[model samples]
Target: MEKLLISACLAGEKVRYNGQALPISEPLEEQLSSYFELVRCCPEVASGMPIPRASAEIIDGPASLVLEQKAKVKDNQGHDVTDAFVRGANMALQLCLSNNIRFALLAEGSPSCGSFLVYDGTFSGVKMQGRGVTAELLTQHGITVFNVNTIQEFIDQLPLVICNQSFINADFMK
Candidate 1:
């Protein structure tokens, strides 16, 4: 079976900053289970942040800028946690590479996993069009990242992506 990297919280793990698991619909879970072997992870937790940890946001610019060292990821208490975020992104990237994972289903609105929209660095619940650190890195390295809200889009594009012989014969869309 093909492997899909996923946010642990989306798989019912209580790994969110508030120590709660995000809700996952039954259909989405069924689709994921049918299509791929799930490899779950939480970048914040992987980076050593505790459950119910301080919320963080990208500062100065988007995750690309942060990866370039031109921006930062700051927690609610104004602590600079840029290093940890970057480290976690790198670790996530390594996991994908090691597993030959080309697709990722990441949590939305997160400083680490957000694939499309992320908090606007103000911690005011405002969102902006931007990818998170891990998402940006994965995209840079040829991985396709999707937010939970975009699962159907991901499924639609899977056939085009899995044209290679290794995945062409797999029962990925069952």
Candidate 2:
């Protein structure tokens, strides 16, 4: 079976910063179970963050800037957590490389896993278009990352990712 990287919280693990798991519909769970070997991770938790830890977001700019060390990831209390985020991202990349994972289905609004949009750095519940640290790194390493909103979307995209070895093989051609 093909392996897939997935957010632990999305896989019904209580690994979110708030100590809650994002609810996964049964159909989605079934699809995930049947289609791929799920390798779940919470970059925040994997980086040594405790469960129920303070919520954090990218600060100053996008996650790319954060990865470049030009920005930060700050908790709601204004404490800097950039190191944890970066470490987690690096670990995530290592996981993909070690496991030969070619795709990721990550949470959509996290500092570590968001693939499309993340919370604005304002701590005011505002959202902005940006990729998260882990997502960016995984993609940079040729892992196709998806911010899936529905089971149907996951189902729809799985075949494309599985069949398209070019995306995964591109890394070796480099």
Candidate 3:
């Protein structure tokens, strides 16, 4: 089975900044594991950040700017956490490279793992179309990132399979 790097929080690990896990349904988890080996990671935790850490968001610009050191990540308590965020992203990239992981399923709206959209640095619950620090770095290194809402797209790209007498093939739709 192919190895798929997944956000630890999505894999039922309590690694979120709130010390919570956002796991998918049991059946879906089982199905995905049947097809791919899940390699879980929490960039923040890997970077030595504690659980229940302060919530943070990229400030002033997108994740690209954060990677470029042109922007910052500030926690809800108004502390600059850009260094931690960047460190976590680099750690995530190292994990991908070492594991030969080509794909990732990250938690959306996370400062470290959001694949498509992240909180807009306001702490007001506003989200913007952008990748998070880790997501942006992984993508730059050629890793395909997916969120819960788009996992089906990844499944659709898989090779044809016959399971329990049912044909699972995206090519048939084409």
Candidate 4:
């Protein structure tokens, strides 16, 4: 049996910065409900923050935010949300490494769970190439994290017979 590390918001939780849940495909939702166990997390919440909170940014880099206090998630209310993002990312990593979690499905364009195109924190929807807080941490620990669209691609790469699959030097070239 395999387990999936899923963003809690994808499971229809109201944990997004604005208190909305992202769209989840029904098949994937059903798959999660029936077969695999989910180690769900909302890094923003796990890190520390109330729902319907303000938004923050990774001003320099996710790592820099962790080091300094700049990478923050602030709402329009002018609150500092650095701790919540950090705390959430750390907890997700612990869950991934300490448990049997190998694959993670994250939310894209988020300050906490964004996979590839995170916002520049201006609320202008200007996206830059970056990893979200929890996405970065989980990836560093060897968990393969992806957004919903990439899920099938990852699955397709796995051999149907994982147990007896064999590889040779030629396989690496392709």
Candidate 5:
């Protein structure tokens, strides 16, 4: 079976910044398990962040800028945590490379794992159009990334990919 990288919280791991887990519905979980081996990760925790830590967001600019070292990620408490976010992203990339994983299902709106959108650094519940640190890095490396809301799309594409024994390009899916 092909492998799929996933956010730990989505798999019932209590590793979120608020120390909460957002496990998917049991039926959906079973459906995913039937298709691929899930490799779970909590990038923030893996980067040595404590559970119940203050929420962080990409500050100064978008995550792309952060990846380029021109921006930063800061917690709500006004502490810089850019390095930890980037480190966790690198760890996620390495895990995908070593595991031959081509797909990721990460938490949306997270500073580390959000694939489609992330908080806008104001801590006022605003979101911006952009990828998070890990999502941007993984997509750059040719991995297909999906967030919780887009799992159905991933499932829809799985048959074509598995039957052809090749990874489907993100473009083709779009």
Candidate 6:
């Protein structure tokens, strides 16, 4: 059976920098919890960031994940950890490749896991429609990704994933 990759924070895991889990869809939680085993990830914290760290913004450019030079995450001298974030993204991709899981349900608006929307990377409080580091890398490699904020939308996509080679061939032909 195909599996889904989920953001650890979304699963209420304490991996978030804030050390808090965002909202979870009860329905998606119930269905996906049973049918699909999840490979959970939190790219930001995974890249050696401490929780309760600075809430960062994406600036410079969205594609490269470069942040504004003056923009620091929080107190205690936050540095631009974009490279670490990229490393975390690579790690998530490794998990997908190893497991052959092509679909991910990330946490929207996070620099690490956001599938649909991310902070402009400027700490500007403005939301832009875009994918995060992990989401971008995953999709670049053909992994379809989602965020649980739209639980119904993702729930509909789950029944369509086919893990085996035969099924993948058949679906590709269609």
Judged by lDDT against the true structure, how good is candidate 2? 0.84
Which candidate do you rate higher for TM-score, 2 or 4?
2
Candidate 5 collision pairs? none
TM-scores for the candidates: 0.90, 0.88, 0.90, 0.81, 0.92, 0.80
Tens digits of per-residue lDDT, candidate 1, 1-174, equal 788999999999999999999857888888777778999988889989899999999999989999999999999999999999999999999999999898899999889999999999888899999999999999899887888778787676666656544373324533
Error of 6 at 143 (Å): 0.3
Model 4 compared with the native: what TM-score?
Answer: 0.81
Which run of 10 residues does model 1 get worst, by summed lDDT? Answer: 165-174
Candidate 3 residue lDDT tens string, 1-174: 567899999999998888999998788788778777899999999998999898999999999999999999999999999999999999999988998787789999998999889999899999999999999999999888989899876675554553443334334334
Sorted on TM-score, best first, the list reads: 5, 3, 1, 2, 4, 6
Candidate 5 has a TM-score of 0.92
TM-score, prediction 3:
0.90
Worst window of 10 by summed lDDT in candidate 2: 165-174
After the best TM-score superposition of candidate 5, give how far the Cα of residue 155 lies from its true spot, in angstroms. Answer: 0.5
Candidate 6: give the clashing pairs: 17-52, 54-73, 54-74, 57-121, 57-122, 57-123, 58-120, 58-121, 58-122, 59-121
Ranking by lDDT: 5, 3, 1, 2, 4, 6
Worst 10 residues of 3 by lDDT: 165-174
Q: In candidate 4, which residue ranges exceed 4 Å CA deviation?
A: 32-35, 62-73, 157-161, 164-174
Q: What is the lDDT of residue 31 in candidate 5?
A: 79
Best by TM-score: 5
Report, for every candidate in turn, its global Cα lDDT versus the true structure: 0.87, 0.84, 0.88, 0.72, 0.88, 0.70
On lDDT, the stronger of 2 and 4 is 2
Worst window of 10 by summed lDDT in candidate 4: 164-173
lDDT of 1: 0.87
* Number of colliding residue pairs in each model: 0, 0, 0, 8, 0, 10
Tens digit per residue, CA lDDT, model 6, 1-75: 557888888887877667687747676688876667777877777777778776765555664433322322232
